[model samples]
Target chain A: MQETIEKVTKVVKKKRAKFPESYIHDIARAAERHDLDDDELDELVRRVKRAYERAKVEKGEAVGTVAAQSVGEPGTQMTMRTFHYAGVAELNVTLGLPRLIEIVDARKKISTPTMAIYFEDEFKNDEEFVRTIANKIGKSNVNDILQDFHVNFAEMNVVAELDETKIKDKRLDFTDIINRVEKAFKKAQIDNNILSFVPSKSNIRELRLLADKVRDLQISGVKNIGKVVIRKEEDEWVIHTEGSNLGAVLKMEGVDKVRTTTNDIHEVEKVLGIEAARNAIIHEAQRTMDEQGLTVDVRHIMLVADMMTADGSVKSIGRHGISGEKASVLARASFEETGKHLLRASIRGEIDHLTGIIENIIIGQPIPLGTGSVGVVMKHK
Target chain B: MKHEMVPDHAVLSKSESNKVLKKMDIHLEQLPKIKSDDPVAKSIGAKEGDILEITRKSSTAGKFITYRLVKD
Candidate 1:
């Protein structure tokens, strides 16, 4: 065993100096277990070196076009349907082509914004604790906890009758609800369990409007979050929320901040900055493609994410974003609104360097890719 | 959450960045870019046009060192 280890180490050191440390260890371990001789180990090292060299990207390769083709071809075969979340019938996630478009476009508001929230150590295994946390995160409007609403037009007042049973079920304090309403409406008065709002004008229309607004007002829980379902995913009880509020969700007591993630890219960007947003885009796109049984390389998705956020902010792939803002005038014109781009370029007296692929392609010249990327000069010796 | 996915980011000094560019035989725009507002970039106080050395753990290779040009 000692002799084999020494032989393997010597062989590894003699081979490619840039060979990864892990690969070296893997070969060394195999050599020890198999007790391979010097000749066999040398052959193995040679084969590994050849494989490594073959795996590297070639110079002058058109990576962008290849990435686009790889992803787009598989995308055409994707089904157009929203998928139901695993074991949850009501929770639907936008999947297939629609989701792919949304991700590339970097839409501010996704069709379905959701969050997968993990619990802290104490609450991870307890279903009861997880349910309580879910209820706390879910939005609670006046309609959810109100027994009745009376718009006293004659008295220029809007009175809300609170349901004690519903409030207790939600684990919300009555005074806290009243305080929130009072803060929302400056002229609000709470006597006992009756909350009254006195409007500035006594018009019936104005009083009715105030009553409507009060009915929809949020009394507790994070705003914008709709239905929250607590389900057992493997051994841990995780909370799946229909709507996403990443900033607020991360601050909750029983929530595991590290494991919680939102589907909205902009929310990730706002709360965690641009790097997290870039990773979110990559992960989301990969997940969407994977659900449809497509196998685009992760590096391709990484390239797209890098391009989208290269300018310090997430931008869509189409007009008003990456394509529209290309440094080359012709490149911008070729993407969209050709006439507008051309007019603007001419007005500004902008010159086209014709160095990029799109511009060269439009002008009937060889694009700057592959063989076209290189320049040659003949010298007589 | 912020620190979990973030790789080790270190801003290269001016001389070192220039050396990298020279060794790679590429212009600043040629290298893959990271945003100036990237959380790792911000934490290290990297400005636009600076180079960031990101060291990531890889399953195939034990460690992989990648560079990104910070862009505004």
Candidate 2:
């Protein structure tokens, strides 16, 4: 024990010798300003340095004295964002500063955390390669991780990455948006000419098939808002589209099965083909507006949902979504109890469940929180 | 190969040598393995059934490796 203590002391002394004189001066200044005694300051510095040393073993910014004070900020709120992957329809997700911090931290080191991530859109999906990248990133050594995954942590912009991840989506709640663009247009001194044309009822199925093509619009692909017209041009079956993929429209007009579009951007051609998803969001928002007594339009919902889900993959809104387990549990608690109750519960213990304990049995068919039977109360008078 | 002691206990076995090398981020291939029948063994005047000790980190820890030349 004495030998071990001596050895540990030697190591500590060596480490303290490496600590810059400037650091000690800074600590001394803060201590004097804060009215903390010099002895207390020295002890605090030693503790912080120990923590910093421990932190250096992991992948992140070293948890120094400054980091120890600013662990987490309470009373902060989160906003939603959208991100698109491989140019599929937008998938929405909730985002905030915490989420931003996560992205910044993730990008701090070259290696990223990996899950059983499923790539949704086309751009040559390599599940195996991506999984390999995930596994490599999960390791300790950043040098090894970067070499294995080919990522440069030093070059990454943490703030920009946070902004991109947390604020990428432009999705609005249905209740939060105006239901129609006419009011917005009126406010902005502009009007969109609605050129109405009635198509024949015999080709309704064909129109639906053509509408299915809207999902393939990518960053490199043509962008078009479609308006289908079925007016006969010289006795021919003319299925004309106003501001959509002319190629997609032509393919549907002349064929039976709908074919995918190629990567091309011609002049004065199709606008971004987000109409079907846009319409779906609009209709859902309209329903919410009606239910919630809101006057918001489908477009705003589309924009918000689009912002949230601009990424090709649609993350679910429930506990299973991208947020951490603590946040998810908090979200679940909000449904069971009041928001304040949940906050109180959170503060009562540092973890989501401090007092929450496991039980072996219950009154009803016990819904176990862990593996076996969980206990629910049945208090008798 | 001759200078390399073929230990009676085989303390520095093939796998053990490789494992030590691995901890140092190297391989046995990176180390100069002595032959069992090299003339340097005769020069050191080491006979068969004699023990040869190779110190590593410290003598007390026995992280220091030794071999017994018990082979013909």
Best lDDT among the predictions, by candidate number: 1
Shift of residue A53 alpha carbon in model 2, Å: 49
Candidate 1 lDDT, A1-381, residue by residue in tens: 555556666776798445776777778888777877788999988888888789877987878888899889999899876665643666878888999999999999899998999988988998877877877888878989888889886788888888899988887877788778878998888887788887777788888888889998987678778988878888999888899998898888988877898889988887776667777888899999888888988878888988997766889998978888889998888888999999999999999999998888788999878789888989989
Chain A superposition TM-score, candidate 2 = 0.18
Question: Per-residue lDDT tens digits of candidate 2, residues A250-341?
Answer: 33222212222211211101222222222233333344234333344333343343332222222222234332223434434544444654
Clashes of each: 0, 45
TM-scores of all candidate predictions against the true structure = 0.85, 0.16
The CA lDDT at A120 in model 1 is 81
True-vs-predicted CA distance for residue B53, candidate 2, Å? 69
Question: Which ranges of candidate 2 are over 4 A from the true structure?
Answer: A1-250, A253-280, A283-295, A298-304, A307-311, A316-328, A336-381, B1-72
- Model 1 clash pairs are none
Segments of candidate 1 deviating more than 4 angstroms: A1-13, A17-39, A82-87, A148-159, A186-189, A197-200, A378-381, B1-3, B29-37, B47-49, B57-63, B70-72
